[model samples]
Target: MTRARTSLLPYLLLAPSLLFLAALFLVPLLQTIGLSLTENGELSPANYQRMVGDLNFVPSLRNTFVLVLVVVPAQVVFALAMATMLQKLRLGRDIVLWIWTIPLGVSDLAAGLVWLAILQDRGYLNSALMALGVIDGPTPWLTYETPVALFFSVVAAEVWRATAIVLVILVAGLQLIPREYAEAAEVFGARPWTIFRRITLPLLRPSLQTALILRTVLAFEVFAVVYAIGGRNFPVLVGEAFVWQTDNQNTGVAAAYAMLVVVISLASTVFYLRALRTPPEQQP
Candidate 1:
C-alpha cells in the first residue's frame, strides 16, 4: 500500500498542471479545429479552400517565409554573441543585461509602433539624415513603391524585439556550462574561436535547439509588428487570419488560417528536432 501511494503521488502532484493545460490549451485547440472543419453549421473543407484561394494568401505566405528565414538566423547569431559577452563580463554585467533585455518587456505592437515612428517620412531617421545633409527631403522609407524597404523594416523590428528572448535562453544555457571545460581548453592553447566552436557550442546545443524552435514558431505567427509597420502593405499569415475574422466576418476561414499557422509551426518544430538532434552521448 505504501508503494502504491508513492507511485500515485507523482500523478496526483501532476494532476493540477495536466488539468490546466487541458482547460487552457487543449480545449481551445480542439474548438479551433472543429471550427475549421465546419461551415454554415455543416462539415466542410470550403474554409480551407477559401483560405488557400484568397488573393493575399500566396503573398502573405511568401512574406512570412522570407521574414522567418531572414530574421531567425540573424537573431540566433546576435543572441549567441550577446550571451557570450554576458558570460565574459566581470562588472556591470547585470546592468548591461537589464539594458539589453528591456525590449522583452515591450509588446510586439509597441515595438512596431516605436520603429514606425523612426522609419516614417519626416521621422527620426529622415530627420537625422537631413541634418547630416544626406538628403534634401524625407525619403518615403515605408512607401508601397518601396516594398523591399518595408519588408526590411519589419525584419529589423522583429529582430530587435525578439532577439532578447533568444538571448535570455542562451544566457541561461551558458550559465549551466561548467567553466572548467572552457578553462581547460584555454590551458591547451585553444584559440577563442576554437574553444567556442568545440567546447561551448557543442554543449550549448540543447539550449540552441530550444531557442530556435521557440523563435521560429513565433516568427511564423508574427502579425502585430508587421501590421504596425506595414499594415496591409505587408500582408502575412496572421494578418490574413485577422482580416478574415474581423473584416470579412468569416470565422470558418479564420480558423483555417489559424490551423495553417499551427501546421507550419509544427512542421518547423519537427524539422528543428531532426536537424538539431542531440546524439545519445550528448543527451542530458
Candidate 2:
C-alpha cells in the first residue's frame, strides 16, 4: 500500500500543472485548429484557402521570414557579445546588467513607440543627421515609399528590445560554465578565441538552442512592434492575422493565420533542436 501510494504521489503532484496547461494552452490550441478547419458551422478548408488567396498573404509570409532571419542572428550575436562582456566584468557588473536589461521591462508597444519617435521624419535621428550635416532635410525614414527603411527600423527595434532576453539567458549559461575549463585551456596556452570556440560554445549549446527557439518563435508572432512602426506599409504574418480578425471580422481566416504562425514556430523549434543537438557524451 505504501509503495502504491508513493507511485501515485508523482502523478498527484503533476495533476495541477497538467490540468492548468490543458485548460490554458491545449484547449485554446485545439479550438483554434478546429476553427481553422471550419466555416459557418461546416467543416471546410475555406478559411485556409481564403488566407492563402489573400493579396497580403505572400508578402506577409515573406516579410515574416525575412524579419526572423535578419533579427534572430543579429540578436544572437549581439547577446552573446554582451553576455561575454558581462561575464568578464569584475566591478559594477550587476549595475551594468541592470542598465542593459532595462529594455526587457519595457512593453513591445512602448518600445515600438520609442523607436517610431526616433525614426520618424523630424525625429531625433533626422535631427541628429541634420545637425551633423549628413542630410539636408528629413529623410522620410518611415514612409511607405521607403519600404527598406521601414523594414530595417522594425528589425532594429526588435533586435534592441529582445537581445537582452537572449543576453540574460546566455549570461546565466556562462555563469554555469566552470572557470576551471577556461583556466586549464589558458594554462596550455589556448588563445581566447580558441578557448571560446572549443570550450565555451560547445557547453553553451543547450542555452543557445533554448534562446534561439524562444526568440525565433516570438519573431514569428511579432505584431505590436511592426504595427507601431510600419503600420499597413510593412505587412507581416501576425499583422495579417490581426487584420483578418479585426478589420475583416473573419474569425475563420484569423484562426488559419494563427495556425500558420504556430506551424512556422514549431518548424523553427525543430530546426534549432536538430541543428544544436548535443552529443551523448556532452549531455550533463
Candidate 3:
C-alpha cells in the first residue's frame, strides 16, 4: 500500500499538467494536422500542392530561416553579455538589472509596434538622421528589399524584445553557481576567460539549454514584428501562414504551414538539447 501510494502521489500531482497539455495543446495540434489534409469535409492533397507551388512560399520560408539564423544567436550573445555584466556589476546593480529585464513584461506585438514607430521612414530615426544632416531627407527603411537591412531590423527588434528572457534564465543559473567556485578558480590564478570557460559555462549548460530551446521554439512563431517592419515585401514564415489563414481564408494551406512550423520548432528544440548535453558538474 505504501509503495503504491507513493507512485500514485506522483501521478496525481502530474494529472493536472497532463490534462492541461492534452486539452490545450495536443488536441488542437491533432485537429490542425487533420484539417491540413482535408477541406470541405473531403480529404485532399490540394493544400500541400498549393503550398509547394506557391511562389512566395519558398522565399518566405527562406526568409524565416534567415531571420531565425540571425536573431537567435544574436539574442543569445546579447543575453549572455548582459548576464555577465549584471553578475559582475556593483553600483546601481538593482536599477540596471530592472532596466535590462523590463522587456520581459512587454509583448512581442507591442515591442514590434514600438520599434515600427522608431524605424519607419518618417519616424524618429529618420527625424534624428535628418536633424544631424546624416541624410538630407527621410529614407525609406521598410520599403527597400535589401536583405541585410531587413534582417538587421528584424534581428534588432527580436533581440531587444527577447534577450531579457534569456538573461533572466541565465542569471538564475549564474546565481545557483556557488561563489566558492569562482574564488577557488581565482586562487589557482585562472584568468577570467579561463574561469568562465572551465567553471561558469559548464555549470550554466542546463540553463543555456532551456533558454535556447524556448527562444528557438518562439522564433518559429515570430509574426507581428516581421509584419510590422517588413510587411508582405519581406514576409517571414509565420506572416505567410497568417496571410494564408486570415487574409486569404485558405484554412487548409495555413494549417499545413502551421503544422510545418510546429515540426520545425520541435525538431530544433530536440537538436539543441542534444547539442548542449554535458556531464553534470560536481555540486558543493
Candidate 4:
C-alpha cells in the first residue's frame, strides 16, 4: 500500500500541470495541425500548397532564415560577452545587469517602436549624423530600395531586444559554476581565454543549449519588430502569415505557415538537444 501510494503521489502532483499543458498547448497545437491539413470541409494539403505558392512565401522564408542566422549568433556572442563582464565585475554589477536587462521588460512592439524612433529617417540616428556633419539630410534606412540597410536595421533591433534573455540565462548558469575550478585552473597558470574555452564553456553547455533553443524558436517567429521597423520593406515568415490571414482572409494558409514555423522550431530544438547533449557524468 505504501509503495503504491508513493508512486501515485508523483503523478497526482503532476496531474494539474499535465492537464494545463494539454489544455493550453497540446489542444491548440492539434487544432492548428488539423486546420493546416484541411480545407473546404475536406482533408487536403490545399492550405500548404497555397502557402508555398504565395508570391511572398519565398522572400519571407529567405528573410526569416537570414534574420535568424544573423541575429542568433550575434545575440549569443553579445550576451556571452556581457555575462563574462558581469562575472568579473567587482562594482555595480547589480546596477549594470539591471540596466542591461531593461529590454526584458519591453514588449516586442514597444522595442521595435523604440528603435523606430532612433532609426527613422528624421529620427535620432539621422539627426545625430546630421549634427555631426556626417549627412546633409535625413537618411532613409528602412526602405525597400535600401535592402541591405533594411536588413541590418531589423537585425539590430532584434539583437538589442532579445539579447537580454540570453544574458540572464547565462548569468544564472555562470553563477552555478564553482569558482574553484577557475581558481584551480589559474593556479596551474591557465590563461583566461583557455580557462573560459575549457572550463566555463563546458560547464555552461546546458544554459547555452537552452538559450539557443529559445532564441532560435523566437527568431523563426520574428514578426512585430520587423513589421514595426521595416514594415512591408522586409518580409519575414510570420509577417507573411499575418498578411495571409488578415490581409488576404485566408486562415487555412495562415495556419499552414504557422505549422511550418512550428516544424522549423521543433527541428532546431532537436538539433540543439542533440548537439548540446550533456552526458549525466558531465551534468553541472
Candidate 5:
C-alpha cells in the first residue's frame, strides 16, 4: 500500500500538466480529426475524397515535402559544421556563440522582410552584381514564376532565422561527450576525420536525430517565409491551410488540411526514429 501510494503521489502531482496537455493539445487534435471526417453535422467521407481530388491540396503536400526535405538537411549540415568549428575553437568561443544565437532572437517575419529587401530588384545583390559587371541589369528574383527560385528563397530565409537553434542543440550535445574519448583517439594516432566519423558523430547521433526531427517537423509547417516571398501563388501547406480557413471560410477543409499537417509531421518523425535507432550497445 505504501509503494502504491508513492507511485500515485507522483501521478497526482503530474495530473495538472497531463490535464493541461489533454485540454489544449489532445482534445483539440481529436476534435480537428473529427471535424475533417464530418460535414454538415454528419459523418461523411467527402472531406478525405475531396482532398484527394483537390488541386491545391496535392500541391501543398508536395511543396511541404520538398520544403522539409531540402531545409532539414541543409539546416542540420550547416549547424553541424558550425557546431564542430565552434567546439574546436578555443578563443572567443563565447562571443561567437552569442553572435550565432542572435538570429534566434529575430522573428521569422522580420527575417523574411530583411531577406526580401536584399533579394528584390535593385536590391543589394543586384547592385553588387552590377557594380562588379557580373550582370548587365537588375535580375528579377521574386518576379519569375519558378518553383525552384521560390523554394530557394524560402530556404534562405528559414536557414538564416533557425540555424542558431540547431547550433545550440548540437553544441550542448557536444559538451556532454567526455573529453577523454577524443584524447584516447588522439593518443591512438586517429586522424581528425576518423575521430569525427567514429567517435564524434556516433556520440552526437541522439542530439542530431532530435534536431533533425524538430527542424523537419517545423519545416513542413513553414508559412511566413513563403507568404512574404512567394505570396499566395506559391503557397506551402500551412499557408494554404490559412487561406482555406480565412479566405474560403471552409472550416471542414481547413481542418482536413490541419490533419494532413499532423499526419506528415508524425510520419517524418517516425521515419527519423526508425532510421536513427541506436545499436543495442549504445541503447540506454
Candidate 6:
C-alpha cells in the first residue's frame, strides 16, 4: 500500500490542477463547442454557416490574420533585441528591467484607452504634430477611410502594451544559458553576431517557441485595443464575436466565431511547436 501511494504521489499532487483545468477550461470549451454546433436540440453546422455568411466575416478574418502576422513577428524581434541588451547590462539591470516591464501591469482596455487618448483627433499626437507644424490641424486617422493608418495605429498600441511579456520570457531563458559557452566562443574569435546567431538563437529555441505561441495566441484574440482605437473601422475576429453576441444578439454565431479563434490559436501553437522544436541533444 505504501509503495502504491508512493507511486501515485506525482499524480495525486496533480489532482487539483487537473480538476481546475477541467472545471475552468475543458467544461466551458465543451459547452462552447456544443453551443456552436447545435441548433434546436440537434447537432448542426448552421451557426458556422451564419458566421461565415455575415458580411463582416471576411473582413474580420483578414484583419485578424493581418494583425497577427504583423504584430507577433514585430513583438518577437523587438523583445529579443531588448532581452539581448538587458542581458549585456552589468549594473542596475533589474531596475531597468522592472521599469521596462511596467506596461505589463496595465490592463488591455486601459492600455488601449491610453493610446486612444494619444491617437484620437485633437489628441496629444495631433496637438504635438500641430505644434511642430507637421500638420495644419487635427486629422482623422482612425476612420474607415484611413484603413492603412488605423491598422498601423492598432499595431503600435499592441506592441507597446504586450512586448514586455515576451521580454520577460526571453530574459529568463537568456539567464539560464550557461555563460561559459559564450565566453569560450568569444575566446575562439567568434564575433558577437555569430555568437548570437550560432550560439544564442539555437539555445534559445525553447523560449522563442514559448514566446511565439503565447504572443500569437494573444494577437489572434485581440479585441479591446482595436475596438478602442479604430472601433468598427478595423474588424477583427474576436471583435466580430463580441459584436455577434451583444450587437447582433446571436449567441450561436458568436460561439462559432470563438471556436474559429480557438482553432487558429491551436494551429499557430502547433506550427511553433513543430518548427522551433528543440532537439533532444539540445535539451537542458
- What is the number of backbone collisions in each predicted candidate, taken in the order shown? 0, 0, 0, 0, 0, 0
State the C-alpha lDDT per candidate.
0.95, 0.95, 0.87, 0.94, 0.85, 0.95
lDDT of 5 by residue, 101-124 (tens): 999888777888888888878789
In candidate 3, list every pair of residues with a backbone clash. Answer: none
* Alpha-carbon shift of residue 257 in model 1 (angstroms): 0.6
Clashing residue pairs found in predicted model 1: none
TM-score of 4: 0.97
Q: Which ten residues in a row have the lowest lDDT in candidate 6?
A: 66-75
Give me the displacement of residue 5 in model 4, in angstroms.
Answer: 2.1
lDDT tens per residue, model 2, 1-284: 99999999999999999999999999999999999999888999999999999999999999999999999999999999999998889999999999999999999999999999999997899999999999999899887899998999999999999999999999999999999999999999999999999999999999999999999999999999999998989999999999999999999999999999999999999999999998999897
Global CA lDDT computed for model 6: 0.95
| Sequence-dependent TM-score of model 2 | 0.97
Which segments of model 3 are wrong by more than 4 Å?
280-284
Pairs with steric clashes in candidate 4: none
After superposing candidate 4, which stretches have Cα over 4 Å from the reference?
none
Candidate 4 contains a number of clashing pairs equal to 0
Model 3, residue 54: distance off in Å is 1.1
Instruction: For residues 49-109, write the lDDT of model 6, one tens digit per residue.
Output: 9999999999999999999889989999999999999988999999999998999999899
Tens-place lDDT per residue, model 3, 37-108, is 997899998888888788788888898888888888888888888889988888998899899999888888
Instruction: Give the TM-score (vs. native) of candidate 1.
Output: 0.97
Q: Ranking under TM-score, best-scoring first?
A: 6, 4, 1, 2, 3, 5
- Structural similarity to truth (TM-score) of each candidate: 0.97, 0.97, 0.95, 0.97, 0.93, 0.98
RMSD of each: 1.1, 1.2, 1.6, 1.1, 1.8, 0.9
